[model samples]
Target: MSWGTLRNSGQERELFKRRSFVAIIAIILLTGVLVGRFYYLQIIEHETYATISDRNRLQVQPVPPTRGLIHDRNGVLLAENRPVFSLTVIPEQVSDMDALIEEIRGIVQVRPEDVESFQRRLGERRRPFEPVPLRYHLSESEMARLAVNRHSLPGVETEARLVRYYPYGRLTAHVLGYVGRINEQDASRIDQVAYAGTHYIGKTGLERVYEEELHGEVGYQNVETNARGRVMRVLEREDPTPGRDLTLSLDIRLQQVAHEALGDRRGAIVAINPETGGLLAQVSTPGFDTNKFVTGIDHENYSELRDSLDKPLFNRATRGQYPPGSTIKPMMALAGLASDTVTQSDVVHDPGYYKLPNSSQVFRNWKRGGHGDTTLYDAIVLSSDTYFYKMAYEMGGAEMADYLEHFGFGSVTSLDVSDERAGILPGPQWKRRVHGEPWYPGDSVNMGIGQGYFLSTPMQLAATTSVIANRGARRPPRHLRYIDGDIPARHLLPDVVRPPVEMGEKSDWEYVINAMEDVVHGSNGTARGISPGLNYRMAGKTGTSQVFSLEGEEYDEDEVAERMRDHALFVAFAPADDPEIVVSVLVENGGSGSATAAPVARQVMDAWINGFPEVLTNQAIPGAMENNGPSGRDPQ
Candidate 1:
């Protein structure tokens, strides 16, 4: 058996050799595949792999440029930028958000609202690893505490950034407006790349109107970062372009004077330089401190401002709509002459009240016994309600509306003024569209005296008066005198120019002007008491707008609530023959135009003509005729 086994050894060896060769071939194929894979990754795809590695270590960041400065015509700073400290956080770097927030409370006075706001921003889509603002306006003590606790807090950071500041406080709040922190809504509207590091945006007024010029170009930096995602160094950078400065036409001195003249009363005043259409002063009383709005106004303070009874937040100059009252009489007189509805010498017999041909409603005159026989000039000086009532009936609503539209009424006066309301100038079509009713002759009578459906803003009134001062020339009100920068000439906006209102006879303009002049200077003028110590001659009109209908009852000022009393209004242009300024004043619930509003206008005009010396001197001494008994409260 052993000998037989020895003969089969050669056959077994052959089989073993074949099996070993097959195993060697299989191993060679596997090694070749491994070598090919290494070559492809290291050589062919080197650039792609290297880019991925570099991205993890480097980041591109945006830098916001400095915001523009705002100044008045006198070079007085109205708005500026001040550096402030803020606390910020990066959510991804935080291990436990709630725990981190609780820890932050110990170092600083971190409010629940702050944490809530931070959480809200974290949920919004933003650049990855960008720091979110937690709290602004950090005090020195808070900064110290943060610095000491920095090592323990992973994501917390303290940054110094420039924030918007209003120097005039409540004086220019309505005109200059204010800036506020950018929110999700702002983020959606703005260019994300341009606004990457920017936090503030203009909220209203001139700030909003010229936002594009105020917000500068963004800069970028390629930065190397560490494993923790902190910036190690800036590898490359592109500098940002600064925003252009703006010099507004507002005269701060006049603005302050007008504001002080209004005092505690809720009122508005708009003064325009007749020669240039520049708004010298725009004042809305009971204005709030604009500084609080810039760095996130506290919720309690904001709520107080939002719900105040006096409405300090309201921009009365551009938004308040009130019946023009007798302030529109001069314009109405011009409209009469222009449309051939009435002649300068036309006479109307007034017996205290006027009635439409078929209507039972009787519109009463301010005088119980009216000016017996009144001409156009007599009607204006005495503010005869019956005379204008008949004239309004003659001209009709359509004619009156068309004439007034050319005077910048029923529309916004300035494109630069934000949130301006177009006042209502009622006509037949307007009545049908708004009230779903036909225009009545009674409506015409009421509107003729600037009541019922007629409403006008202070800005519109000032613009209209400018046309009268210029003898038919019209220039829309403007805030920007000029923009200072390297802007292309073609890109600049054209100056606002409007077509002049044509009168039937050139002599008609002088006739109306002379009548307005008599309103303040005539012996029997309603505002005659305010004319004694005039350094200049001025033409003016005074008006009273009723808050509620008397319904045939005599208006008793003492019986009415202060808020429900009549509104006093006055419009005037100084140096009547060669006017330089046009002013419109409105006093809400101020009772009589002569007693409350006219004196204020006189003071403002005196300030503009004679400078700040006159303002102080006039305030020290009362007008000689302060005893004149409420003669300027015209019938509405």
Candidate 2:
């Protein structure tokens, strides 16, 4: 017993010692590995890990400051920041997201758009602790309801935000385009680092042109948050630098006046300060509500706006292309006089029609009986197509194209807003290049009268008129006056210089200006209707552009559809002696300038002349004359 028991005890003690040795070695190896890993992390990646940890612990969320305000030439606010309340959610603090959404839905109507937007953001894999906005611009009732039910809903909150508002709504929609949500397309175009927390971006018009000035630099706030993502105390904050204010060349009163003058017409009116080329009023009729595009327009509303018959979304002032019709007669007349093709006194006997050199197809006059024995002055005043046809025969298309191109025909005006069409300046080269056809005399005849392939935007027409008013000094048409306190006095850019628009002699311009004045004021003038009550002498040309080609048969206004009727057009500069403003108006399917467009232009000119007092408030008339009142009616 003593021998076996003693051996067993010794073996048991040996086995125990072996196990302890192995255990000690294992512990030592594990401890060495842990120490090496800790050293690697602490020494090599210390800065990165420290930064990441700090960021996670004290996340500095962006607090977007108020954007810059926009005012007219007068200090009346056009665009401003309005206080808006929104609902938000913190996913990390929420246990049941579906239930929370449902709960919010019961309290305040949560739209599919809200759910879809949140889901899209979640898919971006943003941090769960950060709060994401769900609904914006919440009503007071909705906010109160959410606040009342906050005890039952965790991780849900309401926040106050500054939203963009257009006080005039559809009145200034085209000129002051609305801001929209940042999308994939915008992200690709924008610098992600620069726009760290920006949600809305300018999509078009002045908003897009002055984005840098309008979007303020982002600011950060450091607030201590609890384990459940509730803010405990504010540590520090970097106050945001608010965006700088902008003052546009636009006259809000005039803009409102012009908008009303259009009166449901589908067209564009561009008015510019001929002295400085500052755009005073840019009105596009059938304009959509800019507020809808801002924040976010719903699918149905967006579709309706997009698919409407009137095409309210289209910016006709800058983007629309139309044949200038007789409105181009003044430019043609100037071209003829400047080119020495025709003299002011040179007489052309127009017997209702003008036959090109060899061709028998006669280009007929609007007045089928024709303006007999018409000179350049008489031709311009009457808008004689027959006289221009003969001039086209003498000058040819290439020479005429060269002359017209000087007045911004078939060219962009380099406007502040994007998307300007250089209307068709069809020459021998352009016709050959694009249409794969040779230039002909008939083409020249059509181009001479602003027909055939020649097309121009209302902005271009206004710009061209400004050149005439300024006596060949072509100023750049500018919409934005200043950006971030920097004044844009003249837009005559250094890199781009339009070859001096020389009309051969100053007298040539004078003759054309005289004829244009006659067209507005003369007894036989087509636009005489506008002159009956005008206090200031305005020089203008009336035009009627046929939407549909007249196939030899005379147009019966009664038989034709309203859409198929001729578009009335007028280009004018006020106070002929010292012209300040140049305006171009196009009334879609309005038939004649004298009947439809001239009246609208008259209202615009009246506003500009009278210094745009509050609309319809005629308390006292300072310079009210008896014979010349607004639209020939006595000033009320």
Candidate 3:
């Protein structure tokens, strides 16, 4: 057996050849598979993979369009946009958000509220890759410091953006309103794609009303960026469409004059162009600086405004409701004439007070010894409350309400004005619904003189006067005169159109207007004190509304608290024959309308008529020589 195994070399060689053949075949198959895979990746799918890689290096960014500018009728800037520096952060680019925020605190003063707000926005649903603002309105020094140390920060950036600014400060705060940083409530309602890079939105007044027109179209750009998300260069861009510029009906000069005249008083004044229905000047005193609200007002500053007794944040011109007092008499007189309840020649014997035919509850007149044997003309000129009491009693509440509604009472007057209150013009139905009582004769008497639940806003009062100036033609008040240099017709606001107030006889309008003229120019007119220089003919009525019920007690101005006293009011139109401006003034806690409120009306009227005379001239009265007295008469 040992001799046979020694000669087995040939069998061993054949086994080695079979193993080599298997190894060679495996190598050839693997080489073919590797070549096919390389071709598939390098040639067939090149475009798709190339696109994926380019997306990592390049980004599509949104560019916010510039906001529109706002100007007054005289082309004075009310609201404008100014460049400001702000700190922003992109969360996706940040590796450690807490560490980056801490580092930013060293370069810039970041408030806790700011950081909290930033965190809140970070959690909100926003466009992908958009930067969130951490701090706004940065100082130049802070920006410089951040620029020098920016190399160490990855996601932090200092960007210059346009911010809203009001040049008039508090003068136009109520009318122009303000812009504030976008919040959760605003973000939810806004178009996210359009506002991708925008951070602010209008909060109130005209700004809020015209937000869509003011916010321009958003644009986009393709930009190359580094690993840290820093933009290296812009490749392609689509320019944005700018917002439409606005021209308001307000006059800044007149606004300045009205604000200065009201000085330190809590009141409202509204002046409108009777012909065009455009607001000439709208002012609410004790207004706060609107700029504070634009950049997120601090808690302390906001509390001061919100808690102040004067309510600086309130828009009194459009929202404040006050008793019209005698200011309602002119409209009431027109209402009486329109309904034929009382004629221009009808007489009422005002004997210090009025009483219902069956009830003994006497409604006393403002004048203790009342205007005796007062005609409609004499009653208006002298502001005889007793005469109006009788007229209102004769007309009844329903007829009176229907007549006044035609002048836009108890309803919103302007379609364009935001947040205007529809004041209460109480009638039988309104009284029954609100007080759960039937309309009593005494209620009519009290309402006749603009009291007993009667309320009207300064805007409404001005609109009423405008109707009288137009001789029963109704034109709703409007602030927007034109948009983007396009002046459509004279009265552009067609939506605010109201039916014309018709009188049985057209001459009735002239008769009532003449009586109103006598109220300022007549020898016994209640507002005669304001008719000094005869530069122009004006018609006006004075009014006083008691804050508290007198209950048969005489009003002693010195005894009552200033805040508890009567409110002074006046309504007027200048150049009586061809009226251009109609104005209404309301002074809170002012004792006498003729004394306290009329002078302010005179001053404002003079401002509009004579361009706010630098120095009031001393001219002789029109009939002072015959009267043999001073140019000006004492207020009644």
Per-prediction TM-score to the true structure, in the order listed: 0.89, 0.87, 0.90
TM-score of 1: 0.89
- Candidate 2 residue-wise lDDT, 328-437, digit = tens: 88888878877889888899998888887666787888888898998988998888889998898789989988888888888888567676777788888999999899
CA shift of 188, model 3, Å: 2.6
Please rank every candidate by TM-score, starting with the best: 3, 1, 2
User: Whose lDDT is higher: candidate 1's or candidate 3's?
Assistant: 1
Top lDDT hit = 1
Q: Model 1 misses residue 509 by how many Å?
A: 1.4
Order of candidate numbers by lDDT, starting with the best: 1, 3, 2
TM-score of decoy 2: 0.87
lDDT of 1 by residue, 352-390 (tens): 989878778789998898898999999999999999999
lDDT of 1 at 322: 96
State the C-alpha lDDT per candidate: 0.85, 0.81, 0.84
Highest TM-score scorer? 3
How far is 410's C-alpha from truth in model 2 (Å)?
Answer: 1.5
- Which runs in model 3 stand beyond 4 Å of their true positions? 1-37, 489-492, 495-499, 613-636
